[model samples]
Target: MSTYSNDVFLVGTLYGQSAVSVSQILSGAGANVSSTALLGAVLNEYNARLNDPAVQNAADWYSSYRLPTHQEIIENYNEVAALSPTEQLAIGKLGKLTSYPVMIDLGPGNVQLFTAIGLLNDYKARYPNSDPLNLKSYENDYSALAADLTDTFSDTTVKFAGLMVQKGTEWGSNNVANWNDLSQAEKNAFAVFFYKVGENEMNARLESAGGNYVPDLAGAPIAQEFYSNIEGIDSAVVNSFGSWWSNALGSEQGFAEAQKLEYYADFFEQNPEAFSTNPMFLNHLISEVGHDGLRQLANVFDWPLCFAEGTLISLGDGTQIPIEDVRIGDVVTSYESTLPLGRLQNKRVTRLFKNEVAHLLDVHGLKVTPGHVTLCGDGQFAGKHVPIIDILLSDGALVRENGDLIRMAINKPVGSREDQFVQVSYAVDADAAREGNLQSGKMRVGTLLFDRDDQPVSVLDCIQAEGMTFNPKTGLVTRAGGSPEPLYFFGELPRPEDYILRRSRETLEGILTDGEWEGTPSQLVGQRLRQTYSLKLH
Candidate 1:
């Protein structure tokens, strides 16, 4: 089945007043809000709910009136169902309390507990305090209640069952499996998010639950490869995924197989040295730590380095001494916060020698090979930096502002793993990078598009490929394929220019790079070309 199934209930609710419901937004946006700003909103709401004298009274009565059985909780829910949805959610707290007590009796395992913890934290974040309800008093009561549930149940399943009973309408819809306590990778690949929480507590109650903390799936090795290409993850932590999968999968061999097996499958499929090359693994490693995770890890490790210093730069593994000396898989935080900066913003030091020549190729304008890796280029405007990476073509040419063809030289070799520091260098003049100089060879043009499976699409010899483009603002170019065609090239094609072009042309220009390279001290000739010819598809 296509991964794009329409199941609102499985995804959770559209709580409160927002421009649009949670379901309407793309998953990337959804995950961002859910994990960031919305987390604060939910926490505030839950605190307010607890403060309401009516809910407190009700909770107090329910707690005192002989622990309600699972059946009794259901009947209470039925009664609440007759009320408005808002009323039902209010009265639902009573059911939530009862459910946890029973879950304790059941003694459930990791999966069950994991789910429960997420629910409880969600609840707490939604209902911060019982108000004019002394925050402290409510906190004390919440803590006691949480302790009671934790103490009585002993097994975490009690909380899981409670989550189902209370928030079943939202969570129950997802095809959540028990996972048999598998690896963090399995849970993440499967989209199983869980956290633990006490029945009640205040002050950082939203933190990950005890024994309930699963290795962040975003941190798993599998996620580094597949998901990183498509989704951004917390890059502030080198994935020490904890014991979630190890304990669940059981046996050292099982853990190793779970982690490495998927990778081995790819190795066999693409037997080229790409699998063993340091850059190949560094790509995966970058995926593993991600800019965000690495930043966070750096914060955790208290590294002195920061990613927001200036322009976004790429340092090949072991090439960046100051950065690599710290750790290969560690995540460094941005200067301001402890959160990860994500991969695009994150740089891995592949080489570390000073006085090293760096080339920033504007792939969008010139011909590029089928597999050239681009990095952040030097140029700053409006307080942000842009991408500058070494183009694979030895002799590529680029276009200049006067439209003159400038000969491009290869400052650095493609996929060269030597001891050197490539600084923030601008791509040779666009015309230079496109065509060949006396020293460098001819430049080739390439196309970017995903194949049938939605993998990153890169095609060389795209000088004649038919395509389409669209414009939402003008409604022009609204024909069929939605991507414009009849593209032109300037020089020797660099390897893998499509993705780099697509990313740079779309998000980096504004969305991701924040227009840092637009009209900067070092004008980006390639970006200039994209603005002139390339049309937006998304």
Candidate 2:
């Protein structure tokens, strides 16, 4: 009956009369979701919430128009490559459940709640002294009265369901005082409006009828705790509950997660704008929550903040080990901006993405990815990083061959500046032209371009990637894998690096002024060590 805009598919195999849909329907089922076996388990509990599944938008899930019958999901699935940004968020991260237009109509039960409430109020007015509590059980004359109200379509299943909604709605509307204002007996009177409302025969009815509902549900007295458990789960809340199931047919021991997120639920419920800005905030911090709140939940943060292979990862014991050698449960020195000296904490590794990056830079003697964040100084926002190459070419970064300091203003001649300062530019067509690599009409129009500072500009070095953009959110650069950096010399095809340097006095002058680096290709000898590293011309 509901026409969902984002038409979510439940493409799954039928296990006899039972059906098992894809796990993307649930939040907390991360991208690394392995085993359709887990899907079965998730759906088992999900289907158990048979009556009212999700609270609208409460649970997390990835919804899409068409379902891929990609059998790859049976064992492994990283097919986020083909998903929309919203669907990607649902799959790639945890805690970020997306909402679709899945809704409940409530059918006959919609106005039934108000009707029951009105009937109870009229009865109270007729018999002024007969308290509602007196009719708590179907005993004596009350039995006949309760039977009159109990029918197939009404409160036979969930006894007092409408009455509880009535009392809650009325109490809030009429009384100045809240639930805390109610006396103990008065609170018990409201409790009398909520009960189990079903019997063991109801389960048998579901099996025999082969349908969703049970008509003649036998009544049973509910425990005191059951009222509190089902508290506040009205139509709105029930709708929310119904939505999350389809949203992320998803996580964890129920009690443990409930206890952990109890305080969080309170805070976020009040301050919803925190999530309204960036819905992924909680999803991003989910690892931190696991580490801080529940150690059993496996803390793993995919830190794009990487270190080079040989770099040292300091241990809490004051000893150092290579970054690759570090293991989970090892207390490593993790920095907190509040403390000048960082504190040591145990960190666990969740994922390890192999980055054989083309743009590698040598920071001092350490080899690091140009994208690495540790290259930047502290206090910078995450991902706001400067390439290591930028720092090395700066004035203070480079020393003269005689060990003397020199200001390296790229705009001026190579070796002349008052104080140690340098300027850099994104335009580097001159660098390529000086080498005579800029063939006919290849100056600016023939090559790839980038939007620097919102203005279109060229990169100093050419990227082997196909797509180029200032911000990756729009068009992520994907390398078309051939050579990382093609070799050029004397404007010849695939020549050695033996040409170009004269006109580009701005960028190259720092190294050329010092005259400490080479200006020609390496000889085909045993090994040509270039600046403590091998320069294999491809």
TM for every model, in the order presented, reads 0.19, 0.24
Instruction: Indicate the residue-level lDDT of 136 in model 1.
Output: 30
Q: Compared with the true structure, what per-residue lDDT tens digits does model 2 show for residues 41-94?
A: 212222323334343111211111111112221111233334444453343223
- The residue ranges of model 1 lying beyond 4 angstroms of the native Cα positions read 1-385, 389-531, 534-538
Q: What is the lDDT of residue 358 in candidate 1?
A: 19
Q: What's model 1's overall lDDT? A: 0.29
C-alpha lDDT of candidate 2 relative to the true structure: 0.28
Candidate 1's displacement at residue 260, Å, is 3.1
**Per-model C-alpha lDDT, please?**
0.29, 0.28
* RMSD score of candidate 2 (Å): 24.4
Candidate 1 backbone clash number: 105
For each predicted model, how many residue pairs clash, with residues at least 3 apart or on different chains?
105, 17
Worst 10 residues of 2 by lDDT: 517-526
